[model samples]
Target: MATGDEIWEALADFTEQCNNNKRLRKMQRDWTKILHFKAIDMDDSFTMKVVEGEIVKNDKGTVGTPDIIVETDSETMCDMFWGDINPTQKYLRGEIKVKGTQEDVMRIDVITAVIWPEV
Candidate 1:
């Protein structure tokens, strides 16, 4: 199994490369208009970046952070990163949870579709 840092690096590299893609670029630009919520597990700290918005810090000592927590439900993004694993299942299986506005959740769904397009 890949280590946490390895996965984050891969994702970061992929997103950086995607920045060069027209479609992805357009979507990223669009996303800037909306607030983004990113839950990053930084080895020893769990940092949340609100992208172009506000990011409130979490007190939890990070280490096992998720790649990104889309407030909304995006099976595609989940499947892409976590193949065959449904968010609902994870939730039911006591894995992931969210604490944000409903709008944040809804917007995240759209963002997920854009970020994790089937390549």
Candidate 2:
């Protein structure tokens, strides 16, 4: 199990990497979204807000209405954000659960693929 702090740190790093990537920015240029991530094995939830491809807010707790909600173990989340695991594979293996419109889900998957191409 990973601590909440670890997850937060990983999220921070993930956001930084995404924001720094030219291709990711171009791809997400028009994608504005609010996502809620819950750690199923722990009492922790995080919200990430993206606007014009930039992650404007990423912090503990749910901040607003979610366009997407994803649930998984804390460690898995940390691993995914740290580019240590492929989130799509985790979802396929039933390790991650996502509730959202098909478009939103696909968008998240695209983000993961771009961020962690080797994973």
Candidate 3:
């Protein structure tokens, strides 16, 4: 299992990669939202905000009422950020729980797909 710090680092890298992807930038052009992630196992939480096609990480706990709330273990969170795991598959298997509008959920999936295309 990844530690809390490892998960944070992975998320940082993930956001950096997402920001650098033109397709992702175009996809999120007008979308602005905050996503709060709760690492259940670690009892830690972090927030990510998407504004003006850029992903900004805020590891200082919940910033505001997040548009999306994702609950999962630290290891899974790290794996997903590293593109080593498919979040949709995990969600389907009931390993990850998400609270948000369908569109927002799909947006998360889109980001994941763009970051780590299926092989």
The model with the greater TM-score, 1 or 3, is 3
> What's the lDDT for residue 70 in model 2?
96
lDDT of 1 by residue, 1-119 (tens): 33444444443443454444465455444343222223332332223333332222222233233434433223322242432344444444444455545655454444435545442
Tens-digit lDDT track of model 2 for 30-100: 99999999999999999999999889989799999999999999999999889898898899999999999
Model 2: runs farther than 4 Å from truth?
Answer: none
Model 2: per-residue Cα lDDT at residue 54 = 89
Against the unseen true structure, what C-alpha lDDT does each candidate score?
A: 0.39, 0.93, 0.87
Please identify model 3 stretches exceeding 4 Å from their true place.
none
- Report the alpha-carbon TM-score of model 3 versus the true structure: 0.94
> What is the C-alpha local distance difference test score of candidate 1?
0.39
C-alpha lDDT (0 to 100) for residue 49 of candidate 1: 36
Q: Which model is ahead, 1 or 2, in terms of TM-score?
A: 2
Sorted by lDDT, highest first, which candidate order results? 2, 3, 1
TM-score of each: 0.41, 0.97, 0.94
Residue 75, model 3: lDDT of 87
Each candidate's number of clashing pairs is 1, 0, 0
Clashing residue pairs in candidate 1, if any? 71-105
